[model samples]
Structure formats: structure tokens, C-alpha cells
Target: MRLDKYLKVSRLIKRRTLAKQIADKGRIEVNDRTAKSATEVKVGDQITIHYGDRTVRIKVLALNLIAKKNEAQDLYQRLD
Candidate 1:
């Protein structure tokens, strides 16, 4: 799935446009490299998102086109 879409569907960024903007500005990284909004996200891929002075890292556990709010957390696993 596209990185932006994955972020939204997984409830990471809350909105697709915001995710796209974040990705475009290089706030998002895949496997330690800067990632764009259209970047393909696959299972087991590590994703790091920069948020001000803090960073959030996660590993893609699954990809789904749509997911319920209750199930969104299943899409990725938080990393140290």
C-alpha cells in the first residue's frame, strides 16, 4: 500500500493529506531512508516518523485497504 494511505488507514497520522505532506517534507522514513508519499509499504518494513523533537518508529505488520478503529493498531508494531 502507498505510504500515505497506509499511514492514514493504520491511524498513524489521522489523515491522508497530512501523511502525504509529512512524507513529502521528509518527516517519514522507511528502513532509515527518507520516504515519499507514494512509497510502497510492505510487511516487516521499518518506518520512522519525525514529530518535532520526538520520533515514532514502527514496523509494518500488515497492510489493509481499510480497517476499523478498533483494529487499526494491528497494522503495525511499535519499535524502540
Candidate 2:
């Protein structure tokens, strides 16, 4: 899946447009390298998102086109 769509579908960024904007601004990274909004993301890929002074890192566990609210968190695994 595209990085922006994955982010929204996984409920990471809440909205696809926001996710796209974030990715375009170079606030998102994959495997420690800057990632664009259209970057392909797959299972086991490491994603890091910068939010101000805080950073969120996660490993893609699964990819789904649709997921229930309670199941959204299952898409990725948080990493230190």
C-alpha cells in the first residue's frame, strides 16, 4: 500500500490528506530514510513519524484496506 493510505487505513494519522502532507514534508521515514507519500509500504517495514519533539516508530505487521476501530492498532507494532 502507499505510505499515506497505509497511514490512514491503519489509523496512524487519522486522515489521508494529513498523512500525505506529513509525508511530503519529510516528516515520515522508512528504514531510517525519508519517505514520500507514495512510497510503497509492506509487512515488516519500519516506519518512523516525527511529531514535533516526539517521534513514533512502528513496524508494519499487516496491511488491510478496511479495519474496525478496535482493530486498527493491529496493523502495526510499536517500536522503541
Candidate 3:
């Protein structure tokens, strides 16, 4: 799944467009490397998102095209 899409589907960013904007600013990373909005996300990949003075880290657990609110948290495991 695309990084941006995964973020939205997982409810991490709340919206796909916001995910793209954040990625475009170079505020996101995958597996320790800076990632673009279109970067491919795979299971077990570590993702870091920088937001203001805070940062969120998570590992990809699964990928789904559509995730229900209750299932969004299951798509990724928080690492921080």
C-alpha cells in the first residue's frame, strides 16, 4: 500500500491529502529513510511521522484497502 493511503486507512493521519502534505514536507520516514507519499509500505516496516514537537512511530502490521474504525488500530503497531 502507498504510504499516504496506508496512513489514512490506518487512521494515523485522518485524511489522505494530509498524509501527502506531510510526506511532501519530508516529515515522514520509513525504515529509517525519508519516505515520499507514494512510497510502498510493507508489513514490518517502521514508520516515523514528525508533527510539531512530537513524533509518532509505528510498525506496519497489516495492510487493508478499507479499514473500519475499530480495525484501523490493528493495521499498525505503535512503537512509541
Candidate 4:
């Protein structure tokens, strides 16, 4: 899954376009390296997002093309 899409599918970001904007701003990282909107992600990869004075880390648990509100949280495990 692409980083931006993953963020949206996982409900970490509300929309795909917003996720892309955030990724484009260098506010996101994968496995400790800066990640782009199109960055490929797979199970077990770590993702970090920095916004304002907050930082969130999540471990990829699963990938889904479409996730319902109840299922979104299952896509990633919060690390912090």
C-alpha cells in the first residue's frame, strides 16, 4: 500500500488528499526514513508522523484496499 493511502485507509488521516499533503510536507517517515506520498508500505513496517508538537508512531499490521470505520484501527498498531 502507498503511504498516503495507508494513512487514510487506516483512518490516521481523514482523507487521501490530506494524507498526501502531509506526506509531501515531510511530516511522515517510514522505518526512520522520510517517506513520500507514494512510498510503498507493507506489513510490519513502522510509520511515524510528526505534526505540530506531536509525534505518532504506528506499526503496520495489515493492508486493506477499503476499510470500514470499525476496521480501520486494525490496519496499524499504535506504537506510542
User: What is the model-wide C-alpha lDDT for candidate 3?
Assistant: 0.98
Per-candidate Cα lDDT values, in order, are 0.97, 0.96, 0.98, 0.95
Clashing pairs in 3: none
Each prediction's number of clashing residue pairs: 0, 0, 0, 0
Tens digits of per-residue lDDT for model 3, 1-80: 99999999999999999999999999999999999999999999999999999999999999999999999999999999
Candidate 2 lDDT by residue in tens digits, 1-80: 99999999899899999999999999999999999999999999999999999999999999999988999999999996
Instruction: Give residue 11's lDDT in candidate 4 (0 to 100).
Output: 93
Model 1 per-residue lDDT at 37? 100
How does model 3 score by TM-score?
Answer: 0.98
TM-score versus the correct structure, for each prediction: 0.98, 0.97, 0.98, 0.97
Candidate 1 C-alpha lDDT tens digits along 1-80: 99999999999999999999999999999999999999999999999999999999999999999999999999999996
* Model 3 poorest ten-residue lDDT run: 71-80
Model 3's C-alpha root-mean-square deviation from the true structure amounts to 0.4
Clashing residue pairs in candidate 1 (N, C-alpha, C atoms within 3 angstroms): none
For this target, which candidate reaches the highest TM-score against the unseen true structure? 3
Candidate 1 C-alpha error for residue 74, in Å: 0.5
In model 1, how large is the Cα lDDT of residue 12? 91
